[model samples]
Target: MAQVLGGITTSHIPAIGMAMDRHEEDTPYWKPFFDGYPPVRAWLEAQQPDIAVVFYNDHGLEFFLDKKPTFAIGTAPQYHNADEGWGIKPIPPVTGETELSWHLVNQLIDDEFDMTVCQELRVDHGLTVPLSLMWPGNRYQHIKVIPVCINCERHPMPSPKRCYKLGQSIGRGIRSFAGDQKVVVFGTGGLSHQLDGERAGFINKAFDQYCMDTLVGHPEELTRLTNDDLVEKAGAQGVELNMWLAMRGVLSEHVTELHRHYHIPVSNTAAGVLVLENED
Candidate 1:
């Protein structure tokens, strides 16, 4: 039987990745950022999960606004982390879990989740930053990735309720997959911060705490939150939280919080990391 080993939520701030690569973890700007990586890495190592079903939103880099799909899954055997006009990072591409990804894709489609399956796609900073931090080094070879791409940069995007439902569907779809494997659900994005207009540096400590609380104990409340509500509170760019809610939806209702770290000034964004325990 397939089971969720645990859940990880983190901000996909690209600068964090650069700092880690440069061994600047002790620097004032970067030291606080390491708060969650140790716990996350330990969590992954302990669970020894076979697959990582990553829930991350592309920054209009991989899937353009014109051809964006609300939810996309990578069914590829290998995924390259490409640099969109910017250059590629020093890190290498992430190899994918083909069989499990295919099973999830086929099962999700049958379950009526409209998902765009990609055979080959470049994972932008959104996916790579977290991957680099969580599983730095040749560790990627030991773990396989299944990406769940959400459209957060475009309008008429998936509503909060819709994303929650999609997560639920994905959870069921994976469980019913009939495969003998354990999987981990990683929800990557914002605690609370804004990056646009005059509100580019807004950080909502209250709202971020509330989000962490609801995601663990009362996910139903989170599911009811609208995209507009998040933008109003967390900032327009903060609506990327829809991706986090999707990952939370897959876990059990009573999730134990293992580690949490929140910090700001990483370029007008609040960066944080939270781990949810998966029992049974």
Candidate 2:
């Protein structure tokens, strides 16, 4: 049967991708942020999971104000990166496992989580940036991906509890699949920073550290936090941390923290990355 080997959580700040694309990694402004991911890339090279279930939010690239689903799953045979009005990243397209995706869709529906299934979906930096950080040098082409999108841009987004429960359901679904594939789940976006408003340029290192520490064993306590509380404390965009909660819910109760990196001011955001493996 297919097995979920582990999960990764990281910030998906577009500026990080821009730094990489522009070859500015060594520059003083971006070097620290770039330095944080080499260990992640190394860890991924070792684990080499066949598939990645990517959890991220769209930033008006594919879905706009016209129509947006609170939860969406990509079932395409391949997922291409989007322009996002700044041109596409020069990376190979990510392959998809349609059969497994269909199975997950069915299971999620059965579990009472209504998800919009996308036969065609365009991925933006939110999804691809993390892949680049985790699997640099076009290594992303080697593995299949299932894009699980959460609606963090819009209001009335799924609560922390709901995202966590959905992840639990996803874990159950992956275990039920008959294929012998090794999978990794990813929760992308946030470690606290506000991008707009008078309170823009906010960064909450304390809150971000609290989440990184607590999520390992006390995720239930995080579920008690409301989106408003997250926005107030972590920053507006920090609400995206709910995506991390979902990723956490997919792992075994006891996971070993294999790697972690955190940095400040990655373009109005506090960037963070974590790799956790199931305790065998």
Candidate 3:
């Protein structure tokens, strides 16, 4: 059976990707944010996980408003990164863990969760930025990827509890897989920041801190918030915290927070990164 090493969460702002493309990590504006990843990268180097299950929301790259599934999983053998108008260069193709992905699809469906299974999918910054942040350059090619996308753009989005349950289902599936690969789950996007509307550039540091602290030991508390409550407090786009909840769901009931980084006003977003290890 596969071993779930742990999970990671990072903000997936396209501007972060653009900064890396422009080699601005050390610049005054970007240095503090970029400085947060070295310890995480070192940890990855020490524990080279064989597979990564990424939880990210689509930003009109692969799915659009016209046809967006609440939950989607990639079962393709390889996922390609394309130009998504973020002006950032697309990274190399990511190999997929097909067999395990199929296993997860079966498990999720069997667990009474409706899922959209994609045999071919094109990824955007939502998926790629975190990879580049963690692995740097082409080093991410070392592990196979499995993408789990949640719909953050449309109404009727999955509730935080629902997404967390999805992660639980995925965790069960990974443990039951007939292989011994080490897996790392990624929940991308959000601390808090509204992209548009009357309260554009809105951010709630208090809520963001509450979430980060609560997520370490009491994730269920976050699930208690309705989508409206989340939007009202976290800002519209800040609701992407669903992805973080999903990542936490995949871990053991007990976990240790290995590292965390939080910085505000990164492209008008409250960027965050967390490293959690499953406690036996």
TM agreement with the true structure for every prediction: 0.95, 0.97, 0.98
Can you write out model 3's per-residue Cα lDDT over 40-135, one digit (the tens) per residue?
888788889999999998898889877789999999999999988747788899888789999999999999999999999998888999998998
Give the distance in Å from residue 133's predicted Cα in candidate 3 to where it truly belongs.
0.5
For model 2, what is the C-alpha lDDT against the true structure? 0.88
Better of 1 and 2 by lDDT: 2
Candidate 3 off by > 4 Å: none
Highest lDDT model number: 3
Among residues 3 or more apart in sequence or in different chains, the pairs in candidate 2 whose N, CA or C atoms overlap within 3 Å are: none
lDDT score, residue 70, model 2?
93
What overall lDDT goes with each candidate model?
A: 0.80, 0.88, 0.91
Q: Which sections of candidate 1 miss by over 4 Å?
A: 87-90
For residues 100-161, what per-residue lDDT tens digits would candidate 2 score against the true structure? 89999999999999999999998888899888877666567778999999999979899999
Clashes within 3 Å, all models in order: 0, 0, 0
lDDT for 182 in candidate 2 is 92
At residue 255, what lDDT does model 3 achieve? 94
